[model samples]
Target: MKKMSTDNKLISLLRQSYGTSNPQEAATFLSSAIGRVLKMEKEARRAHITEALKGVDLRRDAGGGMNSKPKTVYKDTKATQEKLAKLEATLQEMKAKYHALLNDGPQTAEENTRLKNRIAELQKSIENQKSQHFQELALLRQHSSNVANASELAALQQQLEDFQELSTQLSDECEQHKTRLKTLEATLEDKTAQVARLKKVMAEVAAGDEANETNVHQLELELANAQEALAVARKQNEEYNDKLLATLDSHLAANHEIDELNAKLVAALDFGQVFADEADHWKNAHDQKYADYEELQRRAEQTQTEVQSKYVDEHQRYKAASRKIDSIIEEKDGLHRQITHVRSLLKFEEQKSSDLTRQLSAARLEMTSMTDDLAQEKRVSELYAKNIRELHDQLALLKNRPVLPDWLFSGSMASGICFGLLFSFSADVAPAQRVLLGVCSGAVAFTVARIITKKNHQ
Candidate 1:
């Protein structure tokens, strides 16, 4: 009944004092109550022992046990007492030994002072050695400085020598350059003179070409006049030959008629003696007409032969001229082929130029894209810089905030409050959203509390 009453009292006390909402606090309160009850019980048992000892019937019990040796109660009690005394003595000795061990450092104050003095002496000796070492280091540094100065001086001297050598080389180079300049200048003058000479030669050649062209023009005009005169002469010759052949054929026809007339007259005179003389005269006329006809035929044959020869000569000249014109046409065709090849080359070059232009445009586009990317990168870097600055300001503000008390953030109180808030939010929010907000709030609160506590401590 007492244990049950004590347990109920402990529960009531815990509920009233610490709010039993937190199990850990309730457990702590209960444990403290149990410790208090156990302590009170121990005091009550000691009080009972005192009262019982005062009213004990030691004599009666000894008399009753005397006949049968009383079951050796006193001996047992004495033995127990002795064992307890020995145990107590051993405990006291162990306590004393422990205290001695605990206080076993330096017993005498003077000895402690002497040890402190010795330590002080050692410290002083160490300090003196350190000072000596520092002094030696300073001396060594001075020696090293001297050596460094010597080395630096040597290096400077070497550099000076190198500078002098470089100066000499430069002077030599300058002299050579001056000589080369003079030589180049002379050569330039010569080349200039040669160029002038070439220009003069070109001018002379141009003059000669102009003169030759004028001469060729005059020759062409003369050739045209000669061709016109030859045409007129040929036409006149053909007209004269046609007129002469017509006249010769008419004379032959007239002579043949006269011969026929003379033959008829002779035959008429022979038929009468009185007309004999007239017959002879007619015969003579007939013979004369025959000779005239023979001459006319021979002249016609010579004229025909001359006309054939002239035609043959004119045909040979025309053939030669035609061959020359054909050769000129062949040359013109070759030039046309060369022109066509040149046109094809020009077209190819135009296509290549267009391709190059396209490539250039593509390269320009790529360059523009790269430039835009670089600009974007620069903007991002600027944004990052701004973010860093903002973060720095926020951190400073956090550092200046006030701290929360330990009791407020202790596991039981904070965990209970956090779980309650999480449950309440979870009812209104989605699971993922609740978790995210809970984690963010928890992290922010913890960080702010830490920063505030640190600031307050400082």
Candidate 2:
């Protein structure tokens, strides 16, 4: 069940890290990630070798210390030996704790402090070990005139081997930790850059929103101004309408007065005609009435001229009123057109405001999507880091295991003995020929063993 869960987790990580839904593609991505880690490990190993070579070269060049092989054979007395063992045990415990902390993933501040303290203790232990080795070397050099006992040499050799083994383990662990730290630091830098970019984009978006808001406010102010202008235009129109109505009422009154005057003029013309006929009759009957008839005809001619002049003046006044009404109507039409144009402008501004609002919403959505993408990338980076750590753990396990099996060694020896017997055991074979045959047999056996080992490793 745990293995299945681990596989499923790895599969999920592959999909998320590489953005691949296909199993094959995800596998490919997993292979690539593993390959990258292997490449990094190879590079790190190469760098370590180069640094070690450089250190050796430096030590060789600095000859005094290199020449003085510290040979002060510090007798591994029981008490000193026990202290060494205790220190070694302490270092082992510290190392185990450190590895446990690393495997536990992220740690709290207190845990981090403990981890640092553990690391310091480990360093101090290593330094102590180094100093003790140096002291032993010095003692051995100082006592070089005397031949050392075999048992003492063997014990010193064993101690040196133990120290080398511990150093190798610590070095490997340190390299793995350094690689992980580098990976995490790189990830952190990338996340920081992304956050900065996002912040800059958000700032730009805010500026755009502010500008859009300002435009909207200005448009609203213009719309209010237009509305006020429209209201004023309407008020003026109403006043013009009232004035026009009043002018029409006065024109109607004038027309009524003109009609009454026309009736009076018609009555006067009839009366004059009757009077003219009476004058003619009187002139025919009596000559004394002729002078009075002449006077009455002159008065009638003057009254006709005055009435014609009054009619002409009234006709001119009516034409002027008609022109004024036409001008007023034209002005009213112009006002209506102005109102329509203002309405169109208002609608356009409203549409613009709505468009800006939609743009703002889209920008917000884009920002949200960007944030999600950054979060996903951060998660993928963390998973990749975890995978690297796991790979390192696996590599460490592989390194600890023996490359060549014990069974292979035994089998190779048995096969070599058998091959020698087959080649040199014939009754008729010469001694010299048997020696040659045995050598050939042994060479063949060794070659076969090598081939088998290589194939098994592959």
Candidate 3:
């Protein structure tokens, strides 16, 4: 409860220090504060690890102390490693998928747009072909209706039938060709993309393999060094143990001497023979031996902790290398699948290309046949347009003339209106009055010209 209250107080204090009061502002403040705190925490953890490592050296120098239970430590380390491996595998898989997506996403989108445009063009071409086919069928029908002889009519009908059959067959083939081309193009594109992706992935796999090799070499070196250190520590501890045994023997011998002194005193000849100062010296030596034993025990414990820490550090490094290798292997497997898919697409594209070439040849032949027909039609259309223009001119010359001249009928109203404006300006009249006078004069002049033209027509 106290911890929670203290955390809340800290948050409030941080928010104030960052000059934030609103909830959103506070959130930003909290984020930065937490980030800084995490950085500090990480630094603190690193410091602790270093300190623990240093303590190990200290313990080794002091001599072998009792180690923590090896079996229990091993079990814990194994479990931690297992969890780390699983987590790293998951993380690596996610990274591979994300990288693949980033690489291919834009390319896939661009290919889709290109395919859409091709489809639209295909649709437009098909529509135009359909309209042209209908027009040609109408023309053939008209020609058939005009046939006079039964034999000729039968021949024409047969020809029309053949042409229709050919056209229908050609159209069907064209449609099929288009459909096949679309399928082939799509497959080809798919294969090409897959091949490219696989190639890239394989390269990455190679690079990853090199990285794994390096990591493995590093781990091996570290392991060998650790083994050597352990051996040296063991030898030191053994020597220290031997020295402790020798100290025990000396302490025992001193006690034995004190016992002899006591026995002599008890026998009642030895007030002169017994030494009180020598007894005091033996007691102090026993005390000193016990203190040394305790110190040795403490040093042994520190050395054990140091060895455990070293093992953990090496284990972490090994786990990281294992994770990288696992990721590389997974990518290689994915690349194999992509390569197979690409090969299949390549075959489809080859077949599609062959079909497309045949279709192109047929289109070129049809275009050649249509060329003369279009030119002949254009010439006939031009002849009809020229004749229509001559007929129009003839009719225009044969028509009756107008009663008045072009300028008299067309220009009189314009001239009178313009002169009336000039007269109004010379008289210097008010704007409204001048406008009225100008309109009246122009109206009078137009009425007189119209009367004269009507009389001339009569």
Task: Pick the TM-score winner.
Answer: 1
Indicate the TM-score of model 1: 0.35
Tens-digit per-residue lDDT, 6-94, candidate 1: 65565454443243334445456657655645655677546433443453333333343324321211245778999999999999998
Off by over 4 Å in 1: 1-138, 163-187, 272-458
Q: Candidate 3 lDDT (Cα, whole model)?
A: 0.56
Error of 2 at 401 (Å): 3.4
Q: Would you list the C-alpha lDDT of every candidate in the order shown?
A: 0.56, 0.53, 0.56
Q: Is candidate 1 or candidate 3 better by lDDT?
A: 1
Candidates sorted by lDDT, best first: 1, 3, 2
lDDT of 3 at 298: 69
Return the lDDT, model 3, position 434.
43
Instruction: Provide the clashing-pair count of each candidate structure.
Output: 1, 13, 5
Give residue 21's error in model 2 in angstroms. Answer: 56
Per-residue alpha-carbon lDDT of candidate 2 for residues 120-203, written as tens digits (9 for 90 to 100) = 465456446645665676456445512333344445455555555555555555555555555555555555555555555556
Compute each candidate's TM-score over C-alphas.
0.35, 0.28, 0.31
